[model samples]
Target: MSLKVVVVSWGQLTNVVREVQSQLSGEAQIELVEGLFDQQTTLEMARQIEASGQVDVFVSGGGNARMLRHNLQTPVVAVTVSGYDMLKTILQSRTGDETVYFVHFSEIIHELNDLKEVLPFPVNQVALKTPAEGEAFFNELSRQEQPVVIVGASLAWDLARRHGLKAVYVYTPKAVLEALERAVELARVRRQEMEKTQRVQAILDFACDGIIACDQQGIITAFNPAAEMITGISSQGATGRPVGEVVPSLKLEAVISSDRGLFNQLERIKDKEVMVNKVPVIVRGEPRGAVATLHDIVTIQKAEHQIRLKARREGLEAKTTFAEIVGESQIIQQTIAQARQYARSEATILIMGETGTGKELFAQAIHNASQRQGQPFVAINCAAVPENLLESELFGYEEGAFTGARKSGKLGLFELAHGGTMFLDEIGDISQAIQIKLLRFLQQKEIMRVGGQYTIPVDVRVIAATNRDLLAAVREGTFRADLYYRLNVLPLHLPPLRERKEDIPVLLRDMLFKANRALARYAPVIAREILLHLPAYSWPGNVRELQNIAERIMALALTANLSEHQVQELIGMVLQQGAYEETVKIKAGDLSLRAGERKDDLKKEIGNLEKEVILEALRQTRGNKTRAAALLGVSRSTLWRKLREDIS
Candidate 1:
């Protein structure tokens, strides 16, 4: 990266430049050319050197330097004629009694005016403002009767020598060396500036965002390629034009005037919805200009959607559908049909059922059967994850949000589930603070990350499931009523296994078949005796409990056939002896026992205990329902609700 200096000179000055070049040890590379002022050949030669992109500055004298400066962008240093050069030239060119004529270009050298006091003889000074003027002076010199010694710049001296008159060149070797040094320094500076400009241009060309810059005068200084595409205007056409005239929607003038940045501004620009961000550029406490970055809103959304869907992000999947539910009973079919109808809707769904009742299974089924099947399906169990971690998992967290947070931050399940469904299992287990946030999401369809300063909108259908009665939790001030109502927009209740006994046999077969395929073994079929006795079984865990029994039996597949007692043992383990509970029914406010007379009708027995407790509470509180409810650790409304149910 040596600095290049081009010197256009001839005759004496050319010899001086060669002397300077030979003596120099600096980084500058001097190229000497034989040329004169206002010559087209010399101008073309300089332009070709510049076009090579290797030249930094041009060095010449008088009109030649001015010509290059006017025609080119590279800095041109005009070799200056000092008073010492002029005095030396005059003293050498004249004898003690001869008249001396000195020609200076642009202006008379005022420093030489004081030289008259030091010199023995008076010197006549002539100023030539232009090359034409210098040519006229030389023409007039040719007609003079007396032969006067002429001393002037390179152009003037060349002309004097051409007319066959004695002439002295005014430039010394020191003057040429000084000009070369100045050109080298200036070239270094100009090269640095050019490098900076080139880097900026590279960024403008490669950035994905549309970038436009305006000067303090509201004149567009830069319009990058992306901006050209966005605005349908060329950079060449936009630069130097008033920004308002080029793209008034930019409001660049307003941004500059305000001296404050406006971000995320959604506006219609060039017949397209664009997200614009404008920031005022300030340099040394002064407004230099304003820069704006534009993004097509539709383009941004499409890219995000494509990334969410095509990425098939981790922990986002639903493999179950209605056909996979493995149920044929009327109640189960009706529930599936209703869920199928609900799946077609965009409203929030609240699936209510006990634990081990396939709440999340139904959620996945609904998601698969819905229009958003191909999209993400995110499911999170509210009770399984800790409250703090659940908050971060559900809504995400920013980088450095807390100690040990990931530096890159996190994307929440809500964001991952964008354009799909988010199933919040065990929704009732979420804290009240989370309920507030969930309520906002169900109402506004937006979520704020754990450590985020902004809210991001998510287009996701919500389906919340819970084994706990959310309304009861709401009355107990545990679950938020607003959120409960939001999720209950499309409620789907799953019946327990005891209520849907007809599906037990069907479920048992499906579960065993699945277990067989999974373990690569033969599946054992439960005896008809066990299934017929299943009518007497009170399966608290619904079809999920039936699945447990099937898997247990499949593990004993090599046992040919299980005895009634062995089958009962496995069933007892699955239900924790729930299958042995005697059948009981309420008849006209009377407790009726069908299978046992041991007075173990659990519901009626609990009713009798509850009646005795209520009588005791009434006796202690003088029949004040509020006081009695408070003593029983229940709300007055709950006590009244129980009383109303008893009356009905």
Candidate 2:
């Protein structure tokens, strides 16, 4: 009943705008806004319209409507020439039993074809791009003694009419009447049905509580926005999939057996305690779908904590500082120096490192070191949120941005990061459209909300991080080149754990001490042999893997009184398993071997095995030939000579 509508037209088309507005007078509140003068200003006009904040549905005539719709989130209803309008014009024409040529824009030919199928008279179609083209075509039609029906929306239609050709504008009387009737019927039906449906859907969507609806057969029929927000799975992908497949803890059978509503709290989903309300959606005394609403108990508490923190931050409470960072390695020192230098200048900083290498730690350190440190430090993972929701997460949205959007609306990360730093993690994973918007924000220091207007100026520093090679991504066309250049103003690369071998002992001692304190146990002495092996093994998972291994060792020492020898035994078992798997693969013919050879093959195989062993020893020693030669139990010169002979 309270639908807001905007009528976009040229100032000269006031009469036409009033006619259309009158039709929806009872159903919606209509506001008229003049759109762009030409196609080139379409995006700017759309932005202007959105900034006014007085429109919901953008009803536009002319070619600019298409361009406007492409730029804005508002539903655009473009008025086009309809089948009935063409038929009416043809029937009223004086020329009869003559070949009628319909001169129109090429894009409207499809609509003309549909009309041809229904009309009784035979008609010929010709596409004209401009008024001059239409006039030339009409002149040829006149020479052939054929009647012409010109259908277009620009000066082409006007010129065709002046040339005595039967011309109908895109929004002709017949087309306008048909469109108005359809709009009226649609508005009435939508108004009546949407009230109930929207209220229920709003509860399912906007509430922090997650709601999932399943049919009698336990097939998920509806996965609401809240459900998606909680599970990190999209509603579209979750629909029709089994409930158990979407969320393992739902236990659909329990609800079916009860045949009544049930309220409970479960701790299995996402390792969080969530309160749930499950009820059967019975229609005509038969259960159609079961609805379950759930809310994370911990998240509610966190929300309260965040509110207090925000208040405290605004009240000049001391915030996290550079002193809070606890690392002393040369790599860390160099990274900190770069962060400090870049903190004063507000250029975009790209922080690149492997996962768990503390890219976020460095980002936070940069924010804390900057002038905007006292404000919010908003961080978002581009890879974590689904593509559809990420727009709202970054730019936010107005109330009712979409079917499941919140009634009160939502604020985005950019808004939250105002006056501070917005750290976009895994920046390479963002979609092209989002990348463009982000690029614009970086260029202009302003953002337009997902379903909003009036670009809000944000005094924010951008810190982006990704483990991906952005230059490679640019070549692959996955990341935008312009956005990359914009963010790459200052680049800081954190060395992987294996490359900084000197830092291993320091990290180990710190992690061990932390683990011992947490476990309430004495720190087990790390044998010199174990410390040597640690640096030699590649830490693919980086610092996180090292921390986990340290914790595991500490747990073993505390619970089973495991010694350093036991740790070595565990490592040996893993290596043996890998060797066994490789041997199995070779025997299974998974690896190709050269055919039609006999004794030469055995000699080749022995040579290959010796080469592999030598290469592995050299790799473990980091290409130190002397250590490799010692491990091979061969003289240094003999090993060198053998390696040279193999190369030859």
Candidate 3:
């Protein structure tokens, strides 16, 4: 028993359908089904055909198959007049360069439009409202020296030829017939390709491991669903963003340069040790990209150990210390100094800055500089963990505390940070309940785990950082006032890059040097003009923005020397093109007062101001020109010459 294929009539290609069926008669069983030109009748025919469950493949011309495909489970094959068919038909009907007209049905206008795009000669297409109208239009077009192309089926072709105008019949040519056969073959191949792609995507999506792919340039091309689940970043958010910007652990350039695949069971990122496997994807004997898969090794190990303990129990390894901190800004240095002083005395330190400004660096610096350097430095991002999971994460949980809870127990962040520092990032984002728990911990130096009765005493120093204004939050009743005062004991605000313009040159040089070593490229020279522009522009993303720009500059500078002017030009283009969300706009006057206007106008204004100042100074000095010159911070001879010139 063979699969039954159905062929439906459409347009004027009913004969063509029968011809194809005859050709395939011995190869397969094909059932020919005919329907009216009307859409509803065609759709009803498809529904009846589908109900029979006898059709295995649906074939028709123009929209017949398209309409049937929507209502039927069978494969659809649509045949239409090819471009070559329309072109050849028009050229053959023309005598010399004399104008020839072709008439087409209104339904096939789109095919005619496509023909116009690919055709060499200028062709005019007129749709037939009625056979008479089409004949009249064809006669009018026949008067021109050029040819008009009409695209339709056999019946329409005969109607135009009857009008005594040169008429060409449009249908699929031999080449097009072969092309359709190839297309069907290609569709089978494409289906296989789609299946393979979907399988790979599903494996990447559902796997517990995080997967990330980067191009040869080290820019992230793909981040899988599991990657998003682990990293708390969505594929939509991570795509096109640099790997360094997203994961901060990928070390994209190093991975690219090594060429050799890396498989390490103890790689650390975001404070979790994980097994990482990096493989280079090579095409045509050249490296194209790299794929990395990572899973939390410690969590996996602990889970494995738990399973074994039931047969055996297991183990761990962690701070805010200055030695652990990394930054070289004067603002950071001053912040560290203040944090150190407060750290030894048990004063709550409030480290304030924009997100990613290294508030945790300051917290660590304070912890390291203090007497509690030997203790654990537990850091938590208040905004990262969900509210439901936040309490368990902060305070720990007893066995069987909730569904899917570990059989044994979990140590809260406070317990883990006992005898050291707890750096809370985005502290202002914490809810009132968490704030209450935090305040109690600060007041009593004790924490009660979820579903646990006894309070565990812990000696931990709290250092909190927030991009938000805690004072404002407090006034708005969103944040507790008591917690604000407690945390605000030693306030240190890290100024944004724009404010500390003096630090940019030093920062840029240092960043470039570090990047050079990491990226294995020569550090480009920093132009003074670029430095000047850095200060004028406001850095909404602050130090992080500067870091990213530096990386971008390094990447762009690989093939060319990046001058200060080039840097400014790039910044201007990005601003003009709306690449940067917030940018400072400098007018022509701001660039230079003489810019975009006549120099004479500026000189006149300068001259008037200069004369007024000189006269006033001379009058005040009682015409003792030497005194006026001293007051004006100029030489006595210069003032005398100016006075003489004015008098003359």
Candidate 4:
């Protein structure tokens, strides 16, 4: 891209343009115009040159340069008079008593003064503050009696020559080269600025977010394509109009007045809900204007929903089904049939069963059989999380809702299970406050997030499960009656292992196969004699407990055998461990204390009872941490940590 340069000069100084052309880098193309020195005429000629084509820069001398700079859109570079030019002109002139007059612009008077000390002759200097002042000074000099010799700018020298006086033009080739160099640099900077503006405009047009910028007076200066779509106002109409008139909902004037930023403020523009963030554009500590970015609220919500759906398709899904429920007992079959029927309905279901009785399994099976089986099957244990954190775990929260919150917030289990089933395990263990919130969601099908102000509608089918007697909890005032009734709309009572002992053999065989695969063991069979004794014994921990015991027995032997002693010893160990745990429970619940027993004494007694149970389990397992942890339904780390705390 060649820089287009226009030079305005006198006919005598036409050689200056040739010299500038020689000094120019090949990046510039120069055109010269001579004898047009008047301000009005120079401005017209500059405009004509621009209209002819592109004019990146303009170069001229003194008065013509100043006029072109003020009147032309293209940048104008003025040829400056150097101190050396003034010194040379003074040295060639007349001496003292024969006065030499120097008429120049006021800004260059300091350069002329520096040359005064070097001159052997005294000279008179006249300073022209304005173009008008210079013209008047020239007229006064033309009427003088004595003929004067003058050295100054082109305009002053031309006026002196018209009045029949001798005049010397103070133009140097070095000054013209400097002006041309400056003009080239100015053109480069302007070109870069224009390119940057074009890039920013392209980004604003392509962005999904609507963008708008306003001057300090609230007149809209910019409106992007998205802004037009969101606000229903075209850029042609919005720009140059007051922002308040274009989009009255946005309080841009208020933002400018306060010199502050507002984020994620919901407003209605043209009947569309938008979340807008308005910020004052500050420059050098002063509020210059303001800018706003808007997002359609509905669009944002849909995008969030799509993200969750994609995540669900990638990993979160239910693997359980009715076929996975391994049981042949009448009660188990009846329970499965009732669950299948409930799966056809969208009502909330309450599954009542003891811990480890496969309540979650039933919930998953129900989801897998339902119409929304292909969607997410999210679950959360209400009892596992602390009360303070449970609400966020269930309903999620907005960004910056609390300390250490995720910057973009998080989706809760309920939100993740949209259009599907959400299994709220240990539902009865939730706090009364959370119960009220849950009941509200059950009734309204809407939930407000933790530390949020708006309600979000969810289409999730809730299935709550708990071992606690919700009716008893409701009667005791510990649980909300409304919530209990809401959850108990479809009640399911799962029979305990003791009541369904006929399913033990089948359950044990299936558990053994799974344990074999998981533990990398070759145990593929259990003795019939061992299976016969399992039905007579009460399986306190239900199917899960029976599965654990199957693993224990398989650890003893892999082949089928009729060994009553081995089965008897394993059963005795389990029964003894159950007895010890039962003693701790009974003692801990014992309200009637002996006379003179302090509360501290009762706590100590309970702690000692628990320690004794743990010790007996350790003894039965022969100090094996894994076996002892499984026997107590706890982890090995928990057992070790408990021992450390208790021993200390």
Candidate 5:
């Protein structure tokens, strides 16, 4: 929308409105009218233009400008007499006289003296407080003996002409154009300010939190919709009233005086609990007002609960696949094929493998490849949790079931794994009481919580894993036979590192990259001789042991090429520490030894160490071989060989 301007002019400056219209034609809509500079005429014309709704501002000059500004509500811009206009009038009325009387309003007379040196003739400035006073000054000047030209404002010029005195009017086209430009610029600024106010009001109305603002005098200036709903007060009755009278619960006067802010403070508004924040509105280092915001506490808590649930659900999702197993050996390939076949069925799977054989890795791969891949893949280790807590962890509990039970109860792993896979690691380690309960769950596909009366059904696939032999436990009456057969519906065994020797190089490279990424450092290039020797040594702890050794070697910079003596020292250092010390008992069964001289030499050294350990155990047992075998964590037959001959 363009700015609309109306210019009211006197007859002396007749061409001013036309000049302003021509200059601001495309920029604004100009309205012109001729009228006397009287209060009645100016007020009537201003009201007529405002009633027509065409003008955003008004422009006039001299007495008419002052009258319009005083009596009209719309803005009135007075055409100012610029310094250039004064200079032009002085030159036009110039005579041989050095002293010319310049008369006008008090404000203009002061400006005339600033340009005194720029004029060719000296000027005597006369200031007037009223039109009558200006006419009296000109009438007295007309009686002078000298014929000095009178340079004055429009009012002064009219009085001088009536008295037959020479005069020049000070209003010029340049002055009129300047006034129009200022009025147009002011109109544009006011329009932008109005638009900004509307946008701020809309935001306040739509905000979710309650908002209320008060001036320093404690008068309510703004109350939003949310504030009305929260405080049980209407904006119509609250605005322009004292804040204490509208809402006595909020003490905004305290905030204004302290010039401080309170954040996330708990408050009760209309008997409903809420979190309130009150801050002082500071402008130019002084407090002018205060704003208070309220948020419902119950609503915030519900939002936080939903976020936690979503995070827990996402944490249980499986991110591994068959391709990430990182092995090419035939035994591993056969195990992967069986796992893939099991993924196509919904039967219970029992994976039997030694420790560190990647049982959980295979379980994750099966879940990711199955039809229920998009659902949760929850896992729990029966051996990791205490026996007293395992039953409740699997079946969940009801509210007030125990002294420390949650007020709202909790969902078990089985319930969380509904329509997905639930991997139970170390299944052989559960107590006899839990075994019966697990068997019932497998048979009926339902579970009863620790204190629940009704059974809850779950649609989950079970995958059980164990390093111990379940058949041996069953023979000893430590495990139930029925439970064993139920969990062994689809049995799969994972090969140990000894059986997958050919995949050591591939596993090493993959583990090195993982270590480098995790540690944020680069691994030195491993020597080819070290790679050859790595496959020869027995990794009793399987793939897990190999990964640990690779990380250790990378961290210690053992891969740097060195002399034969240094290589031997490095080998001895790794053997005496790290994975070797943890799995020394199983090295005999897992390692594949070389023939002839090299095999015999390493075997002799290992044999002497074994004998020394046995003798030390026997001394501790006081020469009882059976107790010594138990102390050494080995079978009696293995101990007998160490006492009689070298074990190779």
Candidate 6:
């Protein structure tokens, strides 16, 4: 850390720098700016050096150093005059014939009389503060002696040289070097102090609590970054103003005047509520200043919410958007329209549908389409988990609450879904004990941990889905009627896939595409009759079953392309696997079967599959005989003859 010392001097003072630099080469760097020892030009030069902001100190001799020190903020070190320097200048400039005059710009060396007695020629000494005094003294001396010796600061020495009189500069190389050493030391100390101040300012700037400091008189001295953020007032506007007037809520004035400090005091800054702490700064048993720290209430709560949800929010998200549900059927379209409207309100939603009717799909869509889309979407299936475990998972549990409780305690699914939506799937299957707790959460918007007493307020939108008949359960005393009413604030019913048969072809095409992509080669092609026949099958598992069937068909198709005949055989196998036997037409004599295989089940499956395929084509053509025959890929007359024959 080499210090930049700008020495603003002319004449002998400027000439001495090279000798001074060689004395101390690496510790300090010196730049000589030739300037006179005066008020105007010298101070202006110092101002320019200070404005550059690279200078550490300004060094000069006599009046210039004094002027710079008095006028500027940057440090200025003066080259001092010693008695030895004076005697040397006087001895060097004199011949026994010429009188020696020593005129100094600073205070005169009081021991000059003693120096006169110690083998120094008779020297007249005087001190001059201004240039006019130096000029008058020089004018008087120029006429008095034909040949004379002059020794003094830059002005006197320079004037004597122009007048053809011998002159010696009083500032020796030793004195100038000493001043440079002082300048270098002062610059190092200031730099270290500045580094310390910057470190403290960095901590204050990044701290969460707003810091405001003031002088004893209550005038603001510092307002950190956090303070500006909380108050919405700039430090430029606040500092140097009275703290009480700038932020009246701080109560800094009272703290400065009194001995007591206020801690955790709630105050209002603009429109926001903030918690404040004010304290008096005391030094040596006397009040020196006051400080206040402000914490915005809303910002604090948001940070706490994030800390609690951080680890639990990883996979708890709603990636299913309204655009993902693919269907153009009127029945499905109506349900979507109603659900979209329901998403706008902050009310509990209860979705009712049969198995595989996409209840969770609709729940996720509503969540993504709502205002809480950016927050977490936590889902839990009530029927899948045991009754006691379900309670702990929904409400959390303190350490030692149960046999396997985590030592650090656990955050509940409801708590993790704070600031967003929570999807409680199979809500009807939960026991009455869990239902009552859910009822409390729905009414008050808060929940208590399993073993903990305090309630935590969770700002979440709850959307519940169930395939069970909740109303029937409530009447039978299995499900609570109060909880049902709470969950059914906004009711939505998703229609089964069979009711929207027109959408089957689209779903089948998408499913086949995905399945075929996984196959990469040798994709199976189903006959056109199988595609048309799908709409007639009473889809017991809805869209989910259709997807499973499509995937299975693709897996089987890797063997060979499946025609209408193969589909009938697959349908027979499919019905037999499911053990469906309502309309059994046992053609036991038909199949060459092993003794272990049942003949009646195969016949019954074939009969049911054939009837559904015939019915699906007729429905798709809207009961028009010719169109139905065309869709079935057969002649109209053959279909008419078959219908008349009662093929069933």
Cα error, residue 331 of model 1, in Å, equals 38
lDDT of 5 by residue, 1-648 (tens): 778877786656666557545776456877677776455866887898878867788887766778778877778898887777777778878766635778765455567778887776688877677767877787787788778777766666777788888877777777778888888887777667768998989989999888999998989888999988887889999999988888787777689877579999988878989899999989899888899998888877786657755675678877889999988889999999999999999999999987678888999999999999999899987876888889888888888889899876667788888899999998988899999988998999999888888999999999999887899999999899999999999999999887877777677778866666432222222333344445345554577766666665665654445556654556446545433443344344333332233575775656555566667667868999877765554445445545655533
Regions of candidate 1 where Cα sits further than 4 Å from its true position = 88-95, 104-120, 127-149, 155-167, 303-648
RMSD of each: 14.5, 33.1, 29.8, 13.2, 10.1, 14.2
For candidate 6, write residues 1-648 as lDDT tens digits: 667888887887778877667787456778889886556977887798799888888888877777788999988899986777766667777766787777777776668768878853567777887778877777777778557788877877887787677888888888888888888888888888888999998998889899999999989999998999989999999999998899886678888866888898988888889998988999888999998889899987777667766767888888887777878899888999999999899999999987678888898899989999888999987866878799889999888898988875788988889999999988977888998999999999999999997999999999999876789989989899999999999999999876987777666766666667543222223323344434244555577766655665665554545555666676455444332222122222222342136655765655455456557657766788876654443344445545753553
Give stretches of model 5 more than 4 Å off: 1-207, 217-219, 225-271, 280-287, 310-316, 346-348, 374-382, 385-422, 430-462, 471-490, 512-538, 552-648
- Which candidate achieves the best TM-score against the true structure? 5
Shift of residue 265 alpha carbon in model 4, Å? 22
Judged by TM-score relative to the true structure, which candidate is superior, 1 or 2?
A: 1
Per-residue lDDT over 162-210 for candidate 3, one digit per residue giving the tens place of the 0 to 100 score = 5554555566545334434543454455456757998988887788788
The local distance difference test score of each candidate is: 0.77, 0.67, 0.66, 0.77, 0.77, 0.77
**Residue 543 C-alpha lDDT in model 1:** 63
Give a tens-digit lDDT track for model 4, residues 172-290.
Answer: 67777888888888888887887899999999899999999998899998899999888888999889999988788897877886657999898988899999999998888888889
Q: Which candidate, 3 or 6, would have the higher TM-score against the true structure?
A: 6
Per-candidate total of colliding backbone pairs: 0, 0, 11, 0, 0, 0
- Identify the superior model by TM-score, candidate 4 or candidate 5: 5
Off by over 4 Å in 3: 1-333, 517-527, 559-582, 586-648
Candidate 1's clash total is 0
TM-score of each: 0.49, 0.40, 0.40, 0.46, 0.60, 0.52
Among residues 3 or more apart in sequence or in different chains, the pairs in candidate 5 whose N, CA or C atoms overlap within 3 Å are none
Least accurate stretch of 10 residues (summed lDDT) in model 6? 580-589
Off by over 4 Å in 4: 1-309, 312-314, 517-536, 554-629, 633-648
